[model samples]
Target: MDAPQEARDADVSAIAALDEPTRRRLYDHVVRQSDPVSRDEAATALGLARQTAAFHLDRLADESLLDVVYERRSGRAGPGAGRPAKLYRRSAKQVAVSLPDRRYELAGRLLAQAVEESAATGEPVRTVLHRKAEELGTQLGEQDDNTGVLDLLERYGFEPRREGDAITLANCPFHALARAHTETVCGMNLHLLRGMLHGLGEETLTARLAPTPDRCCVRLDPGA
Candidate 1:
């Protein structure tokens, strides 16, 4: 699935924040340490002023690229410890973006689900894959009760375009894998979309394999 615009923008901002040399250095130093780094420790390690280190660290924390916590450096606590030092560590959040909106993460999830289900039920991998894909597609359709297939597909970066009565998918969310494993990927895509149509209560349209140059392997057309 396409990453939401807001999430994509935030990821871009986080990556852009690291373009500053000092910020990048500070980030690298913090992540490499076994423990979270205090601003003073980062400053001394990177030859940056303590104030500068604090500023960059706070920026990183704000962007959610780094996690922040407070701890007393002195072995003592309560009355004796001078103060809790602010520290920075790498955050668990992941950021990724592709220009054409590749969704290998989505593909991987489907494949993993297929494998697990097949192992458990002794079903063929292909059968499990198709079933899993359809389930996922139904889930996608359920996300917006008010939207139709075209709007839903567009929101997910399918790049749908009107072609007479049919809608041509201009971008495949699984472009690379589809190219490498055409039959399997295309079949999975076809079933997934059919499931989506079913879940959306769409009776007038149908999804079918209609591979063309510079576009997805599936098309949605009006049913008789």
Candidate 2:
């Protein structure tokens, strides 16, 4: 079944609010499992007591990061007397450490403006964008690694999607910035991503703007 976008967005927001350690623990619990896990299993895996696990598990559920499913289990009564335990499954949602959605919306608007300005100049949009991206990538590299780049994108409310060797900026990081200074802000993002790639030694990266209805952004080509 297809997942609802709103629900998935909520999960991403919820996870983004957590501290590093908490987020790590939560992600580890979900990603390593092949099936929905029981409260007992989670506690065991994390070396926490059942009640402790239950508490965090409930929080995750409340955040829509987890869903409760059921499986058959033996009852205390004699043979064939069994019921299903309330098992927990990681929600069909991607978790991210980022800002809220409203901010990202603003960033997109800003990018649209930048795209407009570049278009007006009769410059190939991609060329101008790539040049700006290279500048930003150089600066970002001075401060952090690839992982840091991912974190920065998340904090700015970008939903980062990673596949094999490629990373896509799924959401706009400069939503508020976009609304205030559209062109300039979008230009900055192009630079930022480029700087981030360069910092990560991904200088040979190739990025393509995603098609419409998705918003404006670039991606890293693993092969490059």
Candidate 3:
């Protein structure tokens, strides 16, 4: 699935936050240390005012580039150890952006799951692949908080558009693979949408193959 615009925007903002020279330097220092660095330690190491170090570190934490923890550095017992000092460390969050919406990760996941399941059960690879795709689509549809099918499709980057009584999927989420293995990928696409329609209780709509030069391989048509 294509990463949501809001997520990509947040990632971009987080990366932009590090553009400040002092902040970037402070971040570099914090990540280099094996243990989390306290504000006072970072301030001394960077030759900055204590308050200035705190502010930049807090900003990094706010953007989720740094994680915050509390520790008592004095190595003493209750009430004598003094208050816990706030510390900073590199966050585990990963931020990535790709132009034109690459979903190689999702495709790889589906392919890997298909291979594993097929090996375990001795099922045909194609059958396992389609089943896995359909299951994933159903999970996606079920996660919809009562939104309509079109909304769900749009959220997952199917780019649904109306045409008379049907909804045309404008962008294929599996574009690269679809182009390479048209029949196999298109068949999986068809079943995935079918499962999505079922999960949404979409009695008035159905997914069908209606390939065109400019649009996705699947279309949603009115059910009889």
Per-residue alpha-carbon lDDT of candidate 2 for residues 147-182, written as tens digits (9 for 90 to 100)? 565665554456777767767777665565555665
Order of quality (TM-score)? 1, 3, 2
Root-mean-square deviation of each candidate, in angstroms?
2.0, 16.5, 3.3
lDDT of 3 by residue, 152-175 (tens): 887767889998899999888888
Ranking by lDDT: 1, 3, 2
Q: Which ten residues in a row have the lowest lDDT in candidate 3?
A: 96-105
Measured by TM-score, the strongest candidate is: 1
- Deviating ranges (above 4 Å) for candidate 2: 1-13, 20-26, 74-80, 95-224
lDDT over C-alpha atoms for residue 161 of model 1: 95
lDDT for model 2 comes to: 0.62
TM-score of 2: 0.38
Winner of 2 and 3 under lDDT:
3
Q: Estimate each model's TM-score.
A: 0.93, 0.38, 0.81
Minimum summed lDDT over a 10-residue window in model 2 is located at 1-10
Instruction: List candidate 3 stretches off by more than 4 Å.
Output: 1-12, 19-21, 98-103, 180-184
TM-score of 1: 0.93
Candidate 1, 210: how far from true, in Å? 0.6
